[model samples]
Target: MTQAAIQVRDLCFQWPTGASVLQFCSLDVPKGEFWMLLGTNGSGKSTLLRLLAGLLQPQSGEIKISGQVGFVFQNPDHQLVMPTVGADVAFGLVEEKLSLAQIQARVHEALTAVNLQLLQRRPIYALSGGQKQRIAIAGAIARQCEILLLDEPTALLDPDTQLDLVAQVRNLVKSRGLTALWVTHRFDELNYCDGAFLLEQGRVVDRGAPEHLKQRLMQ
Candidate 1:
């Protein structure tokens, strides 16, 4: 069996208001696998992603994740801090104390992975919404993260852009052998996923191949 990239057991989380968000028996993401987290509004999709990203502490249970984790938010604007694509991609690496040449090399490799190398010096404001999201992915790649957590990353894009971004992200993740947990409510998006976990009120109700889950929903 493939080694697990992310593992959770008896995981539980509650909001400050004493409302529970996640109460799961167990969850696991095997290395190099892609799983879609499907849930409706108020179903804790984003909450789960946040917990996986270590943004919030769980009230109880355990979360074991391997390697570095990178988060790509629903809004690319939230991740882009610098003026240009190259600057934004390298923003997180500034504190790593690496030489300028090393940083440049990492930045180039990441942008090239996302097919954005030519736009490295382009202004962030000049890029389209889809391009902005790709830049966010590039930033994560530059960080050399082994796992990626995406919380409805395509929610704000147009239909065409959404499809394009999803396809690009799927390809990047597969090619890099990175594990990803993508949260989305759009059923059609599952076409680009390998497997899926369905959530309701923070509980995993079902999980299987994306096509299988879609058939179950239809029935």
Candidate 2:
């Protein structure tokens, strides 16, 4: 078996308000693979992503991640905090205590990788939704995370922007060998995923290659 980049075993979670979400959920994501998580609203897709990111603790389970992880929340506003684009991209490196020159070099490289070099000095508020999303991605890349998790990354974009973002993510995964777990309701988007898991009422009901799951769901 391939070594898993992420492993979850018998996971369970419930909100503070007594709302139960996941139960007995277990999954493993192999390194360098792109997996799409499909489910309807309130179906624990976002919750599962949070668990993978280490932002939320499972009530009763174990989650093991082999390397650093980057998470892009459903709301860009939640992830983009710095006032300027450059600062935001550099935020992750602040803890490293790198020299100013080194930070600037890494910031420039990360921005250019996402095709956001021209907007380096721009204010965050002036950016379009797609641009903001790319900036968020750039910030994640700057952190040098081996795994990227996104929750509804293209939810609010126009069709063109949506396609562009999807292509960008796919390229990131292929070129950088980054493991990705993307959660979205659009079943069509699974065409880009190597494998997929179907979530129903917080549990993984079925899982397989995208085409197989599609056929099964349709039948």
Off by over 4 Å in 2: none
What tens digits encode model 1's per-residue C-alpha lDDT throughout 63-90?
A: 8999899899999888899999999999
Give candidate 2's total backbone clashes: 0
Q: List candidate 1 segments past 4 Å from native.
A: none
lDDT of each: 0.88, 0.87
Give the clashing residue pairs of candidate 2, or none.
Answer: none
lDDT of model 1, residue 126: 98
lDDT of 2 by residue, 145-212 (tens): 88999999999888788878877888888888888888887767778888888888878888889898
How well does model 1 score by local distance difference test? 0.88
